[model samples]
Target: MWVLTSQFSRNLTSHSSLLSYLPDVKVGKTTDTGKFWDPHFDIHFCYKPNMKWSVLFVLGVLSWGNTLATMVPKEATFYQLDCPKEGTLQYFMLKRSGQAMMVDNTYKVMEQNITIHSNGSIIFHSLKVEFEGTHLCVMNHPDNSIHGHEVKLRVRPLPPTDLWGAVYESMFVTGLIAALVIAFIFALGCFVYKKQWRPRPEDEKPVMSGYENPAMNPSDDGESGSTNM
Candidate 1:
């Protein structure tokens, strides 16, 4: 039995296809001396090279998918101001979980025009270009834990008031270019027609009556000759 098991092991490793035709073998009941009464052989199993690589490839794909799912971007708060006049005051609430928190003094204030209150409210006085950027609000909780939040700011200029200015603002560059191309083609067509098809002074001729010239009165001279004859 030991020799048979060794032979199976060697055959399994050398030719993995042996597993397909291998059958289950059960040894006979053991006797008092711990020896089997019947002859049986044990089968050994081994993995093929292609099967091993396929398992590794599947594991790699699963790991990569999990990494991508974890790397998704988080959304942040944003604020926009439309043509805010100078010296105008603006307010924003940075409250979280319905609790009022105080700002951490360790964080430096980058914008002089902005102020943070103990109630998680941010205020911008005399809003200017310097105030239009990212602001960080760091706070200390009751448990002495520190937390930070980011706020984005944007400023836009006033809209145009006149008709042409409004139309220009509403139209994109491609639309403007197309309009100019059409006008240029119309102007070119008008120029070509005037230069090539319009009548010239040298090509014009005067219209004369046939009876006013001697060469055109041949019938009258023939009539007088007949009368003389």
Candidate 2:
């Protein structure tokens, strides 16, 4: 694999150099068999010509993988990016080379919300959800060599809120809970006090009507009845 890679590298360099001089060599000409053809000569006679497309495919895959890796947080040196809540102010600094500083490189971002400074810094006055995407910062030199960096801005949507909004929401919920707890405690205390200390009804006392009572009259009545008999 290494041998093939080295050979392909040399061939690619040679092909690039040849393209400058040979105008007739069409770079993207392909055969009916879906194989890439060499413009200078017959592809079958060329060295490992059948493997060109495969090698190109491998290089493309590697490049794509590198791009994805760079987009991740740990490897974001290639770009300036921020994930801020929507409508918040945000700032970003672009990485620049000394060579870029020495040359007259024009710097600009495409978004209207972004302000590009002379010192390779940018600011977002208020971030928006629509700003979440890859943005380009182009630096064009006097020699017409265009250098560009991608800025990946991600705008997080604001969290949902009720009528209280976010700042007062926690306090409102806490106060409501406290009030409910206090009410429950008061009701429980009243119930316990009623059960433990409240007075109960006493048993009714007997009425004292003297001789007309049943016990008092019973003996006298029986005795009188015997005497009469």
Listed in order, each prediction's TM-score against the native is 0.25, 0.23
Candidate 2 local Cα displacement, residue 125, angstroms = 0.6
lDDT of each: 0.48, 0.50
Candidate 1, residues 9-49: lDDT per residue as tens digits? 36564665654544444555565644444445533223234
**Runs of candidate 1 exceeding 4 Å displacement:** 1-112, 126-135, 151-157, 161-164, 168-176, 183-229
Error of 2 at 160 (Å): 1.8
Which lDDT value does model 1 have at 13? 45
Task: Kindly give the number of clashing pairs for every candidate.
Answer: 0, 0
For residue 173, what is the lDDT in candidate 2?
A: 89
Model 2 whole-model lDDT (C-alpha atoms): 0.50
lDDT of 1 at 16: 51
